[model samples]
Target: MWVKQISVFLENKSGRLAAVARLLADNGFNIRALSIADTSDFGILRLIVNDPARAYQVLKDAGFTVSETEVLAVEVPDRPGGLAGVLDLLHDTGINIEYLYAFVSKSGGNALVLLKVEALERAVEVLGANGIQVQDYHIVHQI
Candidate 1:
């Protein structure tokens, strides 16, 4: 299944990140997971929130550059090499991972990996055929 991810482009300055966080909090958005990639001038703030559409509109109205992407939330084991195993599966299937970020699940048993990959449909199929659990958006939204 696909998960909605919101990406905000932020100027690299103090308090910018805080401002976004405050904005989301003020709007009652629960951040399920987030990752930041930064350079000298700007940064990309990727987020999985309870409400992606609302978050996007709010950020846009606030003058923050934003975009939405479809990513996968995969349930992987919490032990050593858990992630490696998934990577290996993708690699063997020739599915290139664009990027990934992970967080411990709120339920406290498994790790949830947010993955952006080339050939999304194929990746999902491969993961499914291999018995990997790709979480649905409905489940992730409640986290």
Candidate 2:
């Protein structure tokens, strides 16, 4: 299964990030997880929210650049070497991970990892075969 993630492009300046967060909060959207990758000029704010469609539209209406992406939310064991084990499986299967961020699940005991990978279908298959749980979008939304 694939999760819907929103990527918001933010200019590098003071209060830009807070302004975006305030907008989302005022719109009643709950942020499930987020990560930011930045350079000197701009940054990419990747977010898994309760409502992707509304988030995208609100951000666009506010004159922010936003886009949606299909990513995977995987259940990783919340124990030693859990993440390494998952990575090893992907590596052995030749699935390249472009980027990833993680958060502890509020309703579960496992850590949830949001991953962007090349060949999403193959990666899902490999993970499923290896007994890793790839979460559905609906489940993630509820989180």
Candidate 3:
């Protein structure tokens, strides 16, 4: 399943990150996952929140340059080369991945990964066909 992800363009300043976090907190948004990529001048903060659409609106209204993208939540095995094996499979299947962030949950033996790929639907189909678990928003949020 596809999930909505929020991406905020933030200045490469210290307080800026805190400001975004505070805004979300005050607005009653629960963050499920987050990844930040930055340069010397600015950064892109990617977030998977419980309410992505609402968070996007709130952030935009708060004057943050924000956008929403469709991403997928994938479950990777916890053992060694687990992620690598998945990547290899996608590569062999001709799928191009844009970016991904992963975290190994304490409750489950598998690792949860959020992936923004070049072809969303095909990746989902390929992963599903190969027995890889694709999670919906509710399942991801619960983690």
Task: Give me the candidate number with maximum TM-score.
Answer: 2
Off by over 4 Å in 1: 106-108
Candidate 2 residue pairs in clash (backbone atoms < 3 Å): none
Instruction: Give candidates' CA RMSD values in order.
Output: 1.2, 1.0, 1.5
Evaluate all candidate structures by whole-model CA lDDT and list the values in order. 0.90, 0.92, 0.86
Residue 96 in candidate 2 has what lDDT? 93
- Model 2: CA > 4 A from native: 104-107
Which residue pairs collide, candidate 1? Answer: none
Best by lDDT: 2
Which digits, one per residue and each the tens of the lDDT, describe model 3 over residues 1-143? 68888999999988999999999999998887899999999999999888788899999999999999999888898889988988887899998888999744632677888888979889988888988888877677666
Candidate 3: where is the Cα deviation over 4 Å?
104-108
lDDT by residue for model 2 over 1-143, one digit each (tens)? 78999999999999999999999999999989999999999999999998799899999999999999999998998899999999999999888999999854643778899999979999999999999899999999888
